[model samples]
Target: MAGRVGVVAVAQTKFEEKKATEHTAELMYNVTREVMGQTGLEFKEDGTGIDATLAASYDLFSGPAGAYMFLGYVVGAYRREDERVLEDGSLAVYYGAMQILSGHVDTVLLVSYNKESSVGKNLIEWVGMDQIYQRRIGLDFVSAAGLQAMRYTTKYGITPEQCAKVVVKSHRNAANNPYAMCCDNITVEDVLRSTMLCDPIRVQEAKPTPVDGACAIILASEEKARKITDKPVWITGFGSCYDHHELGYRDLADCEALTTAAQRAYKMAGITNPLKTFDLAEISEQYAYQELLWSEGLGFCGKGEGGKLIDSGKTQMGGDLPINPSGGMLSGLPVCVAGMQRVAECVVQLRGEAGDRQVPGAKKAVAHGVDGPAGQLQCVITLEN
Candidate 1:
């Protein structure tokens, strides 16, 4: 597919487990400033620069109402147009592309941040659930993921050892990443020995909490993209979908939302066989099992074949298709920032800039993101050189 939107510049700050020194504005500036410098672009009144600003952050995590408003000012959008999404970085970039596709803007500035240390994760997610049933039982993301894991494992014959491999691969890959947070050279036995946060979900399997980070990206129309940078990572296709909010209403073992979203994106990008179409992937897997579960939803394998896929050694470094060469969210990317960083990592790989963990001749890549208990909402973004 000939792309209409392209990402000309992308930047991200080193993610930390607890970055208490900087405020949200500082985090925004840290990345936005770098991106602007890369492109030498600004918010011009004559419509030659960034015409729209898109941010991925929520009032819950931000700790204040209209947090995006102040963030916009810090990025030189004081009185200019700005928008916000209560989703992940992939969705924000998805909307930014829409801004250009809709003829609303030729250029868009995308930003995403989450200071997880500022607030408690469980309480925040709990409040978002149904007050009468789900929240009353103290169901948060971790616990919810446990329920899903139980069903997925039991139904598909997936083992804890298979799930443990994901953590091992993620941290090992992260060891080579300069911006990732968790990069211990741990093994599968170490993961099985780690404390269990939720039944069937070990502490090591989940992303270490209280993380803080931010990312910024510049999206431009095909015409403006060529003028902004000689090399542009084109946004070939994207899609998103929402599942039933109640756990009882949906199949915990299946990622229906992700399947629909991937189908939509694949259709737009003319992808008939995902495992063959994508040279690499950067998926937001907050937990180890998600890498397996989400991969099936992405059409990399048949349903219930995630365990077999991992055992095939086809997704590791130097494999036919690598998933998350930049260490991924499992390597410490913040919630709101992971999706965009995935896209950024893909841009770097596509540009031949990924120093050590680069996939040879990577041209087409997929970046995925999701939110809510048991993966209630899902989004997929496909990119190419």
Candidate 2:
């Protein structure tokens, strides 16, 4: 907390429907190799290279409780201090920053990825519920999200058309992101007319495909960061919170967890006004309606004003503050990796490396992610050039 934790390098693979040709280890190695190559750092334990390694992933998604052992070797963690963040990927960055800020490590490597296509043995979403309660009630993320969508939209007067606009914008923005999954142009009419999966939430409004991808980032303290790169992106602030697990306990219309987590990060970053404080935002939206709900939670607008925010085109690529210029989670990011992708995108943007989706003169950005049923858990990280 004294100096600063900075992200000196980052890399990610093109998110796609499947990566059957490559194993998960390959994904990890590819990104780790690229990121380390960018910084000229190795796994030397002599205090001159990466001091620790962190992997952001979920054991459930990988189908083995102790999978990190096999992964550790692939990411150059052989006999090195390697740990895993079982929640959303953004938290790994949070944990890595803390490691450096605590003076326990000078440099860290974070690799986050999950092949959604390989999760065939279990229903990752449904299995997340309690066995005796929610599971018996038959609730998966889609249906549960549907319940939230109806409650949020009805309570806030957010029209289904307004939610559809999110899908149109996501796909359109994905075109600018070469690492994005297969993207096709779509319209609000197209989203509204698409297959209705959960009443107001249409098929087109959800992540179009299960994607396999990996993202890697190298983090260092201020002293090492300056030596690694002239354009180091600093991790100025961070926060995470988990709400009540039971759907019955929460008000489906509002996400208090997201607001609390965001407020903590904003306070640390001295962000009194999110819309004016940051030039852009990368939010993890599993569904289109979530983008609206999360924007409000992030304090982009007043309560019940999320619908107006999206409808105004204020969150577009060329708007006052672009939201998801790199196509966000709705484009195809898997759950665990989605939040980390948001952070990686922010690093790219702040480094002036995001080619077509770049936000001009973007000195600041926020990356967000959520887990659990209906955003029960939330994470926020603020980054700056």
TM-score of each: 0.98, 0.98
lDDT of 1 by residue, 1-385 (tens): 2349999999999999888889988999989989999999988989888898888886788877776665668766667788878888899999999989988889999988889998898888888889999888888888899999999999999999999999999998998889888898899999999999898999999988978989999999999999999999999899999999899899999999999999999999899899998889999999999999999999999999998888888888988779898888788988878888999999999998888888899999999999888999999999999
lDDT of each model, Cα atoms only?
0.89, 0.89
Instruction: Show the lowest summed lDDT stretch of 10 residues, model 2.
Output: 116-125
Evaluate residue 92 in candidate 1 and report its C-alpha lDDT on the 0 to 100 scale: 92
